[model samples]
Target: MKSGTRHPTGYWAEEFMRPHQAFLAEGYQVDIATPQGRQPVVDELSLSLGYNDNDQKSVDDQRAYIAGVAALKAPLVLGKVNAADYDAVFVVGGHGPMQDLAVDPDIGNLANAILSNPKKVFSAVCHGPASLLSIFDKDGNWLFKGRKLTGFSNAEETQATFAGERVAEPDATGVPDRI
Candidate 1:
């Protein structure tokens, strides 16, 4: 989790939970990890009922999982993770990745290793793709250069109103530049 980034979009976290639960149901073990071995700080806005208005169950499930899951309570340190131990890597997006994962050398190396392996699957969602900025090819170019990708758009950021005020920072660099 990024130390300074906050106010993660609630919907994004909920989106991740769907797949997470599915994986668990399929008998796959889920391991939560962070750059450091500290508990991740979730944005308060993400915990609001409004985010899960249509399905209160989703919000309830998320809350229950967070409170009951031991892995999330003490996530593995990113630096200690070995790429060979996992078959896939899923990077969950929020405002957080832009702050730390985007530039963290350990995460960059891990993403690069996983992406380079033919048998391994590497995936990221929304702002999670920002972490790809740190991954470089052997020729020293961004690994995602020329690949089609999408994430939280500038328009969405500008249009988002939190507490009846525009949420995006006026001088905020667009997502492309941040990567």
Candidate 2:
């Protein structure tokens, strides 16, 4: 994607939609956010027949599901969101967060604000956890030091790379060794 040619990628459809559906079932008001306030793109690969167990209907449902989410059409910009306004922050995963959320300072600030408070929750899956690399204290210390965490695994990335998916390597200097 660096040669001025863009390969489409964003939130993994099942990764996002499954959690979104669960939240709605619980009657929670879900608000979507992106680094720059644009509507999120769905990782096309996530909707392919191979990923969907060869079910075209499943792929269609995922496409329709994302399109119907009004909040996703105009998601809040991460910098503009007040962490105090929400009880939890859920970061969705895909190839996109490796480029956006993982590198945004606002994500670090937001994570700090949410995690510092015991009443709030912060969670992410797959590449979404890459954003945790952004969490740092005012003194530049990693806030998640010594905490047990997991994200997209090296083996998984290696497999994706073999499958021709472009994966960016994010700086992990601030992350705890346990990650």
TM-score of every model versus the real structure: 0.78, 0.86
Q: Mind giving the per-residue lDDT tens digits that candidate 1 earns over 1-179?
A: 12333444322565456677888999988897788866765544555677668577777777776667688679899988999899888887666655678777778888888988899988887667767777777766777766677766666555544221333331222223552
Report the Cα lDDT for residue 13, model 1.
60
How many backbone clashes does every candidate have?
0, 0
lDDT, each prediction: 0.68, 0.82
Per-residue lDDT of 31-136 in model 2, one digit per residue for the tens?
9888878788888999999989999999999999988999988889989999989999999889877668777899889999999899999999888998887889
Q: What is the lDDT for 134 in model 2?
A: 85
